[model samples]
Target: MNYRIEWKQILKNKEKVQCSSDWISAESAIQLGEELERNGKVTDLYFYDEMGVSWNMKEMRKLLLEIEEEPHDITLYFDGGFQKETYQAGLGAVIFYHQGKKKYRIRANNLFNEMETNNEAEYAALYFALGILEELGVEYKTCEIKGDSQVVLKQLEGEWPCYEEVLNRWLDRIEEKINKMGIRPRYTVISRKDNKEADKLATQALEGKEIYAKTIIL
Candidate 1:
């Protein structure tokens, strides 16, 4: 997670002024906050996360310790493929996260028989990934979401307007789930080549091969 340090600083002329630093990592914010406290000139020190939630030095330290045992530094990759011939859709999701000192990767895929379009499938794949995150107890954390579907990513980012009612419904469902899970998502569009892993998983699902695996990366 990232935070900005905000506090009141006492100037040499006995003037009190508010000061805030640029957004930085939680660890860095804590380190800097401690150093500022040692100077004895800084007061009301606090850190605010991207969600605009503020935390005091004591609260932040305790929260950091708790977060270390859960999932953090998360990156999710998702893709979906639809076959018009049979109205079948395959959804794939891959998640990478840090728990304590270890890094882990999870791969999962599913097949559905009633998808209307590939765009809908793409949205479903992202929703499926969110379910995985919830099962892993990920909450109140930033997640970097990557996918190759321009329509899905752009629409989610509000860069492109979604005119289809079906797609809008999917968008609503996805947003509702995200809010309920307290997930902060950063969406990125990547080339199909760069998303080969997720693409392959979707393809495997279409071939009737299912997979759900998690492994330690470091």
Candidate 2:
């Protein structure tokens, strides 16, 4: 997680002012906070996360300790493929995460019969990824959501306007689930070539070749 540090700065003339450091990772903030404590200049240490929530040194320590036993950083790549012939949408997701010092990847895909447009299918792919996060016990953490669909990425990031009623519904559901899980989502749009893993998964699902695996990278 990322956080900004705030402290009270007192001048030699007895003038008091509030000072803040640039946004940095939570681990760095904790290290800096500890240094301040040792120097006896710890006036007020506040750690502000990306979600706008503030945490003290104690809270930050506790959260980091919990994360040390499991992965807290996560990234998800999603892709959706729709076949007009069968009116079936195949949604796929590739998730990368860490458990302690070990890295792992998860590949999953599912098929939907109701989605009409390619945009709707893309949204379904993201929703499917979120379900996987829940299953992995990810909560109160940030997850990078990457996709090749400009429509889905731009609309979700509020950079582009969504006009379709069906797509708006999908948008609402995605936002609701993010808030419910206390997940801070970072959206990134990449090229189709960069999303080949999830793209292949979607195609495999369309062909009824389901892929669901979790493997560790030693």
Candidate 3:
């Protein structure tokens, strides 16, 4: 989590000015707000999240602390494999998160039929991971969404033109869902080696194995 420090330079022996810090981690902002309040010179402290919602010093501090007690700074990795012979798609996702000083990982996989292309399966895997994030009550935060598929990455980043109607619709749906969730996604393209866990999960799912595990990293 990152935040910008802002002072309202009032010139009345105190800082007075509306500081619009952009892309700040809400948790960090709350801590800064608390420190400012302790100065006694701060007439008002406001913490603005990425969603533009304002939080008072006390509320912001409490929320930040509570979030600290909970889990934050989530990373999700997703991948999919489509078997051309059977038209079966295998999906996999790995979620890494932090709670207090602890780190956790959640692994999941699924198998589905009816997907026409590997690309569509790739999109499905990402969408599935987001659904899990929503269930965990982690939204409106800075998150990294990664995949090994260059096609998926380029298409999502808008670097490549998507002419297929099916892919275009999937892309639009993803954009809409992301906006509604207020997520700031940092998309990255990783090598297949780095994405092996997810790849293996998908393969396992395709072989009729159910994979679901969550573990804490010591």
Candidate 4:
């Protein structure tokens, strides 16, 4: 997670002024907060996360410890494939996260029937990934979501306007789940070549092969 440090600093002429640092990692914020305390001129030190939630020094320290034992630092990739002839849609999701000191990756896929278009399938794939995050007990954390579908990712980021009623419904559902989970999502678009893992998984699902696996990585 990333946060900005905000505090009140006392100037030489007995003036008090507010100061803040750029968004930085939690560890770096803590280190800088401690150093600011040692200077004895900084007061009301606090950390503000991307969601605009504020945390005091004590609270921030405790939160870091608590989060270390849970699933945090998440990155998810998703893709969808649709077969027009069969009206089947295949969804795939790949998740990477850390729990304590171990790093883990999860790969999951599902197949659905009667999907209208590949765009709708793409939206469904992302929604499927959110379910995996929920099952992993990931909440109130920032997740970097990556995908190759420009329509899906851009619409989610509010960069593109979605006109299809069906797609709008999917958008609402995805946003609802994200808000309930307190997930701060950072969306990124990548090339199809870069999304091969999720693409392959989606392809497999379309071929009647389902997959679900979790493994540790170095």
Candidate 5:
């Protein structure tokens, strides 16, 4: 979890205004808070997470204690291919995650004929990946989402406006799902050439060759 550190520094028998720092890792925030307490009196020491949930030091420490010793690191790559003649869209996703001492990668794909355009198909492919994350029980963490579709990535990131009604609906649904999971999503737009892995999987989907695999990295 990431937290913004906020506290009041005592100065000359007066409490200065509360100061806040940019979000930092929870572990680092805790250590800094402890060090501040040891050096001198600090008042109103607390933290606010990315979702704006406030936490007292005691509560944060307790929660950190409950978390696994190893941290969660997850990345998702998605691509979509649409055939105008067939009106079929192929969606593909590659997910990499780590837990304890093990790292794993999963590849999956789907073919659907419902989307009307390639942009819509791109959004659908990303949504499909969210479903996979749900199956993996991912929640309350930061996830890196990368894709080749500038429309999908920029719109989701609010860097570009989405004027299409269908795409707006898909955007709303994706936002709702990720918010419900307390997920902090970071979107990166990559060149098509840089997204060959997902591109290949999407082609395979279009060809009726489905893939779903998990491989542990040694």
Candidate 6:
């Protein structure tokens, strides 16, 4: 959530103005508005998010408070693969978000040889994504976690029972991490075609290719 301040004309008497900042974490907006009012630069202040959504002082304050303890909408895609011959695993994720006026994507992948099964690899991939999101400070917003694997999605959503002790442990860890981050995970299942970018990145990891990226907005 990032914002910029702008002045505009609204109606005949109301001055149309916008403040630039991440409404996802709007604590600063209220303070900034009060400071502007104190300075006599503006009688009142209004905040608009990157989406041009306007919020009043009270509403903005409430959102900030909630966000301080909760997460907002963040999209995460996870994919992974495993090889039988060497017990090698590869994982990938693509995190996309828009806060304030900026849109960002964080694409990442990892290679590990210790994983025993595809399910573990998939969970590890999702974990890799969470690590990246944590680095980007996304724990402060809501998260939309997407994956191509139905097994992972179903288990994460508690739609299917995970009986494997190892996998169950992984599931618990994932949930714990999400909770610690204050993330509200909205899990969804997408077809492989829809998750091509992340799938390709995961395959690249299997091929021993290094990971690359554009940006990971915090």
Which has the greatest lDDT? 4
lDDT of 1 at 188: 95
What ranking of all candidate models by TM-score puts the best one first?
A: 1, 4, 2, 5, 3, 6
Q: Write the per-residue lDDT of candidate 2 for residues 1-38, one digit (tens) a residue.
A: 67888888667776767888888876788998888778
Top candidate when judged by TM-score against the true structure: 1
TM-score-best of 3 and 6:
3
Better of 4 and 6 by lDDT: 4
Model 2's number of clashes is 0
The models' CA-based lDDT, in order, is 0.94, 0.88, 0.81, 0.95, 0.86, 0.77
Off by over 4 Å in 1: none
The 10-residue segment of model 6 with minimum total lDDT is 2-11
Stretches of candidate 3 exceeding 4 Å from the true structure: 9-28, 36-44, 69-71
> For residues 170-198, could you state the per-residue lDDT of candidate 1 as single tens digits?
89999998999899999999999999999
Residues 49-89, model 6: lDDT tens digits? 65566766677777766654433457899999898788988
RMSD of each: 1.3, 1.8, 3.0, 1.3, 2.8, 8.6
In angstroms, how far off is 62's CA in candidate 4? 0.8
**Tens digits of per-residue lDDT for model 5, 1-218:** 57888988888877577777787877788898888778676788888887788889899888676544433578999999998889899999999887656788999999988679999889889999999998888888789999988879888989899889999999999999999887899899898988889889989999999999989988
lDDT of 3 by residue, 1-218 (tens): 45555556455755466655555677656656666667666655666655556667767667777877765788889999999999999999999999887999999999988889999999888888888887777767778899998887799888988888888887888888788777888899999999999999899989999898999999
**Model 1 deviation from native, Cα RMSD in Å:** 1.3
Candidate 3 vs candidate 6: which has greater lDDT?
3
If scored against the real structure, what TM-score would every candidate get?
0.95, 0.91, 0.82, 0.95, 0.82, 0.69
The predicted structure with the larger lDDT, 1 or 4, is 4
Error of 2 at 201 (Å): 0.6
| Alpha-carbon deviation at 86 in model 5, angstroms | 2.6
What candidate 2 gets wrong by more than 4 Å, as runs, is none
> Candidate 6's error at 169, in angstroms?
1.4
